[model samples]
Target: MTIIDGKLTKHYARVWDYCHELLRSNPGSTVQVGVTVNPDQTTYFHKMYLCFKAIKEAIGRDASNQVYPIAWAVVDIENKANGKWFLELLTEDLNLLDGGGFTGLLEATKEVLPNVERRQCARHICANFRKTYTGMEFNNMFWAASFSTVESEFLRKMDDIKEVDPNAYENLLARHPHTWYRAFFRTDVACEAVENGIAECFNAIILDARKKPLLAMFEKLGCT
Candidate 1:
């Protein structure tokens, strides 16, 4: 916000200090500032990532039951470096030596979530299937492939897909059955969920905040 005629606080002006103050006030806060060296040799602001106390704790508190940010970043550029830096900081702050897990950007997850598994969103898959294939049998077979608690059941349904619609079956094969199917997910985490809607919910909660100034938005993550 511009102070057209009022007193100016360091909160909006001195970004570095503001970040430090946030860290001081909130013990578990995590903040990363990305900077780029200009041609003139001076460093300029690039982007930032902030994970407040609540999220920090959520990542570190428990193994089986934990809250994980499902693919998010604060960088202007959505490239590998930015993602790697964000996750590297997150991993350091939370001591997440292994994959803590998240949904949303599978590529971002791939950069950080090792040992942790990926689950494909069944609803999204169904939506896509509806676009390419006809008949309820395809949906039923997809569901069967996803819902199967055992390997045999999943394979049987997959075979069903191959038989019914060879083209759709080929598409399904491309998506990799292990991602959505329960028969293939790791039993370590409590999440048997095949939907990535957590990202949706998280985004909705922070959507307004995301448009706010850095400090203001960063503070919102800590409150919850």
Candidate 2:
């Protein structure tokens, strides 16, 4: 899981390092990481870990002009807690000893953009939920809970989750409903979006382009 962002083709670790450095060097810059994961593995590899060490060794001998720092991990599960563990390792590697510098997006957003209303993407929630719970029942119930525009309706949907599985109910309960569900969003925004579908769609459009060489990827994106 590598992602290319604008001029930087960085692995997740490199991105974390870059953000950490930028913030430390220049206090004016704002940096935040929205933690998420692909619930399923790729077709070729069923395992959840990347071979970063092997890739790093290969890169060491290569004479390429480009610099690609790799950071990989083997996680028992793909969840927010495990994601934080991966970040902790990266922080240690980057020598960000002050510890308190890194903060979750929710806290940062409140401090930096207090007036702004934040909405969690429903599709992302579904992806994370699918990690622990599956099938159409859970999916439908989850969406129902998310889409509910009334507090009573939302509670009803949650009750549905509790009926299906008390553990699943607890899981969903832990996921901060006020940010994702329709009932809790500010009415002033006049936006009813439950998911970040536009960004997802754009990523899908550039899926193949992202796997190509730098120049080739740019060319493909230009054409797209």
Q: Judging by TM-score against the true structure, name the best candidate.
A: 1
TM-score of each: 0.71, 0.50
Q: Could you tell me the lDDT of residue 66 within candidate 2? A: 34
Clashing pairs in 1: none
Instruction: Tally clashes: model 2.
Output: 0
The global C-alpha lDDT for each of the candidates, from Candidate 1 onward, is 0.66, 0.59
* Residue-level lDDT tens digits of model 1 in 1-224: 44532223433366677667757876866765667555787645446666754654432223765446622446656678777887777767666776755332356667676754656687787888788886788878888788898899988888888887788888988887777778877776656767666555666778766666656666665454
Please state the error at residue 69 of candidate 1 in Å. Answer: 5.5
lDDT computed for candidate 1: 0.66
Candidate 2 worst ten-residue window by lDDT? 43-52
Q: Which has the greatest lDDT?
A: 1
